[model samples]
Target: MQLFIVGLLGCSLVLSAQALYSSSDDVVELTPSNFNREVLQSDGLWLVEFYAPWCGHCKSLVPEWKKAATALKGVVKVGAVDADQHKSLGGQYDVRGFPTIKVFGANKNKPDDYQGGRTSQAIVDGALNALKALVKDRLSGKTGGSSYKQSGGGGGGGSAQDVVELTDDNFDKLVLGGDDVWMVEFFAPWCGHCKSLEPEWAAAASSVKDQTKGRVKLGAVDATVHQVLASRYGIRGFPTIKIFRKGEEPEDYQGGRSRGDIINAALDLFSDNAPPPELVEILNEESVKKTCEDSQLCVIGVLPHILDTGASGRNAYLDVMRKMADKYKKKMWGWLWAEAGAQMDLEAALGIGGFGYPAMAAINTRKMKYALMRGSFSETGIHEFLRELSVGRGSTATLGGGNMPKISSAEPWDGKDGQLPEEEEYDLSDVDLDEEFRKIEL
Candidate 1:
């Protein structure tokens, strides 16, 4: 009887130990049976971990994984698979080690490996970064069943329209004469590697066009047809990519050939060449209209009066805005500011008066909608606010009047403190203090 009771107790302990997570946790326990239905078919991004119950590293990751799952509840789907028990699923994904984190983005069959830290915050950041890339790919029509035609000179899956065909006739006039930065690929039709690079180049071209606002261009040249231009750049390889800039020697492209790599490199070049967005003061209708209309989203800051915050304080606030503008320059958003009470109509339209000075509102002029910044005015607060908006998680309201507000004309702020109006002295020496008192008494 004693032996039976001990055996039963041991069995219970083993069973409990095998079950690492339960319904109490946010993690969805996955298995081979439901893996396809739950994660493979889902449209949302999934961060799945393949782990073993006996592994020490996997055990440590359990708590952090649960915490990350809770934080990314709605934005991203989090799941776990007991790869030790479900060997079939583990082998399917080639999960040789324990606690392999995979980010299932737009391409479900080929998920990317998560190389971030083991902490919850690191997991969250990685998930958000993956989501952002997915969003960008969708916006560029690279994913969601969109097919790239192989019509252009290259045999890759990119459209001919996107990858510009450069020739000797117009190479110098277009590339060297123009102020825009150029990434030109010299490729031969018979080269196998050049064919593989064509799709990546085409996709990068499409994304770079929108991201850099046409400031950066990607073009391809057939080395065999344009031997003069290719030899000028000393094209020794089959697919040689060169970066061309105004008043500078063409340099070899040292980056990877992947679309993401190309886009990042092009953006780096654009940032080095492009100036920080101009922070304009909203002084008139034209000022507000032009700033808002010129970009995808316009960030408006309603700062305090020059008297309330001296020039130094005001410049500090503007400095924060400038930093944020530089940080998000890739998004190509417009930045504007207005002194409190200087643009009362604009404030009312954006519902900024109730929020107090140093408030912010991001307006999508095309959508006629705006979102207010409820967080602090500091960099961290502003980054959180904008991050939420970028992921389409923040609340927004339609612009008042369904149109741009009537901006009142005002003088630009001078680099000096505001002065109070002088008081006019009045003499009431013979006037009616006693007379009024007597009249009231009567």
Candidate 2:
């Protein structure tokens, strides 16, 4: 009997230790059971933290999270999930870290990572900023909800303007010949399932277009109207989706039929087809000009000199930039780095010298505006800096002299440690040092 009582007490303690937030706190404790109803289906903005109770960082964030929740009580919904206990929920949102904060703004299905600071004030500020963006999007007719009712049977809530109409004549040239990845839907006009998917397909098309910068396209064909095209692909169903890549066989789409699912799948295809952005060295005028002009935004990093960081240390910094470039590959941004003092004119133009070595600046070549990174050089810091610029929140300044500065030609960094310039040796054997000293003294 004593052993049974002790076991019950231990179980209670274990259960208690699993939960970090309580009823007294303003944070809403979320689990898989209530997550959909509380967050996904709700119209309001939500800031949710997926955290493990045993993590030291999670523990440290507890008080600040509570404070932020309390401060944002009426305006925003703040929630906490014990991800350690609810692995399914954590995995669903791709929460790989111990403490991951996601902002469920206008689109709950696709949440944005909270990239701001961890303090209560920072948390509150981020939530408010997100709220402001959501409001702005809604006001500009970028409604994210699934409540739009379709009046016609063929079209639903999907944005038809964004969806390319593929016919038998244009199907081969556009889908097969084009270099861009394509998500083509073979649909019949009278089919119920096709009607149901129209809105999702249309919405996904708009999102995919913006996110992939037209690298991935979404197209629809009337299988009933174009029997030859449908027969070639063996489209037997009402709405059969196939992915098309250049020089590759079309693969069947096996993802969910929601807007978010379609967008995610299309993004995956884009990433698979697209190569990582090249991390160029700012060696000359042509190098800098070509890279900046080709991309929507150019990210320039002034790495420490090879002498200071060594090859290993310089490679580490480059690795960080490469990872960030890969992460934001869809943005089609250019990544370039130069050794400190290698491109002094370029550094001065971007205002990089003030921040010292290992600094970063994101420049919009079109606007001739640039934003500097005032954060650490780590992954988390760079992610935060880029995320802020992405949402159009960060402060930007016009490029120096309202134009790109002249890039001085520089030698590329060899993958070796730097060496000091060899000092000139004097042929002093023919001369007398004593006589030279005496002459100088006289």
Candidate 3:
């Protein structure tokens, strides 16, 4: 009996130890004290999980979450918050449930919900998608980079800045061999446009340096002196801008030669080098809230009931959304979807049913404003609506009661081609139909 008691105590101790030790996953453990410094102010992307110790689902998510964290160690920061122990932190983001995953973008205050499957692959896919979206936004001039205001000035005017002077000797070593995205201006010393663009180029170099954390550079070559380099690039004009992407053929800068234009173009180049956006199906309130908080615009689609359309029709709708998303990759907007009647509150609030199935709504949740697509749901029609919205020309409406309608828990898409469930057929061989009908009528 004493031996049995001893063994039982040992087992209890083992379980206790396992429970008390913080997760061994590669994720950084977060608290209110360090959350701001580690996540908010950091430059890279972050995926954080808010969890409770006692919750079985949270416990189950640990292994897969850790695997994802390990896979994305340097590319994306992975973190976990013990929401049960840190009630105040949970309340700040309105985390009402256990095992809530949120993607914190460049903006720390707004976090998008993670509704991907609990598998390791799903988690990694979701993280990469979020990272791509953030990068795209930075490229779109929506939000990001060191804030540098354009001012009137000429080239090489006052202070030396980020643009480096490239001679024939250094051109091959710096521009061709290096991995950073580089913009090289080939110019003659006496060229008037080159002189006029000097100050704007200098200012842009400084901004790009800070924004890209030195992953991109600006350089200038005196075409008169570097004859060989100019010949190699086929530079015909006195002042020509060429973009050098590592391991790829250089592209000519065709945009306007203004400070704003240059900065926008450089940002686009940086984004093109970064990962493109990944689309995820909407499954819950956290996903909806987090998306709204993180993005300048959230495009949500309402599809017809699966029974009505089957897998073919459903897949068709999703394909359209995906293509449009790729076309507007620079917009850096969040794309999500739901069945027409699944989130009735959202459907009603957005008035999605009137236009029929497969309708879409572009929402600016931050301002509680939205614009609907009254046109067809094809690529052309959708493009027209977005084009107008992009220019601030679309008609808008205040969200119901000036608030984003609350979203509820929903089953996430299985990432499979939608196929309608087989319908059940029942037969009644010997029923008194007339008698039953007369009784019901009476």
Candidate 4:
């Protein structure tokens, strides 16, 4: 939902008090003209739910909002506004997107709101629970015995917001295939360290929001809900935070971290261009194999991407490959020829969408029938990758478990997988990295 100013309307003062019935959890009619008294005078905590009429997510949130309001009476009052219905109101508080549900009174006694989205239940629960926690804090004398003073609200918490919810769909849509640097924490609910480090991740996201702003993104894979994603990424431990630079690929940490620690990690990957997804689909076993095998001059497909791109960058990196191959023909080949990027058909064939950019996939048929160049390579890394693949230069290593530095490559050759298993089929429609979570809902 886009934001537009209400003050420009020239009619500012209107106090139509049509909130939830004292006996019913009906929708509240709060407008920009009346937000002050009805919302500001909330005895305890307030949850102003922002929604848009065209948003499917917002519609789903309606019933859940009513239920949460009903279940959470007395502690915090819940109210909702159709962001589309009241565009002017959205601008007054800087509401800048669709299906956004903001929660006021999240901090102790102070007024705070959250930009919560995704499904209705998650947003409704997060906001109400936050306010409920605030009420408990006030009752427990967290804020100078009054409900307005915050316990930890010293100079620490800003008049800023943190935390976002991403569904698997949007997670890929927005996060996966961009050129921006990204840091993701793979954490589980039962892990004590994961539970403790929540605030650190938030602080880091906030500090970088203004600077990294659109260049960097922070996300979490509730390992409890996304075990397959964790496994695919080789997440072996709790509180593991992984950072992906624009062209340098992704690096991960297995221990816990502080706000400062996470913030520092973010700065390391900052780049003006975010990695795109199209490049990643090219590196799935078959794609990497074909892209490499198709190259005759010890083809070099440098993968300089992190995690993988869903669209353009994959193509962009390939375009870079095409240019390099064409420019340095003498250094590459004719029968010993080299072309770059995913060979379109290969991308569609595997239904995989990463592994070509920020990486180097090479084949040295002279030495072995197939051999990968390496991970995102430095120019020197590129040479090292060729040498290692030269049959006697170094033994080929399996690609599954390694940090793949500037000078490492994954070789499906010389392994016990037994001749590649007839080009295993994969379809994006059937891909559910979080399917395991459905069996055990958190």
Clashing pairs in 1: none
- Please rank every candidate by lDDT, starting with the best: 2, 1, 3, 4
On residues 1-442, what C-alpha lDDT tens digit does candidate 2 reach at each position? 9999999999999888777899999999997667766887678999999999899999899999999999999999999999888876776676888799999988665689999999999999999999999999999998664421222222222233377777788878778988989998898777877866765676678778887878898888888878999999999887899999999999999998766678888888888789899999999988978888867799999999888889999999999999999998877798999888888877888887644789999999899999999999989999999999986788999987788888888888879998989999988889999999999999
Model 3 lDDT on a 0 to 1 scale: 0.77
Model 3 regions lying over 4 Å from their true place: 1-181, 186-195, 202-240, 251-255, 260-276, 289-294, 353-355, 415-442
What lDDT does the true structure give each of the candidates?
A: 0.84, 0.85, 0.77, 0.50
Best by lDDT: 2
Encode model 4's per-residue lDDT on 93-112: one tens digit a residue: 45666555555563412345
What residue runs in model 2 are displaced by over 4 Å at the alpha carbon?
1-179, 189-214, 232-237, 246-265
What's the TM for model 4? 0.28
**TM-scores of all candidate predictions against the true structure:** 0.61, 0.57, 0.48, 0.28
Model 2: lowest-lDDT 10 consecutive positions: 148-157
lDDT of 2 at 347: 83
lDDT of 1 by residue, 121-187 (tens): 9999999999999999989987643212224433222343356667787777778888989999898
Better of 1 and 4 by TM-score: 1
- List ranges where model 1 is wrong by over 4 Å: 1-160, 427-442
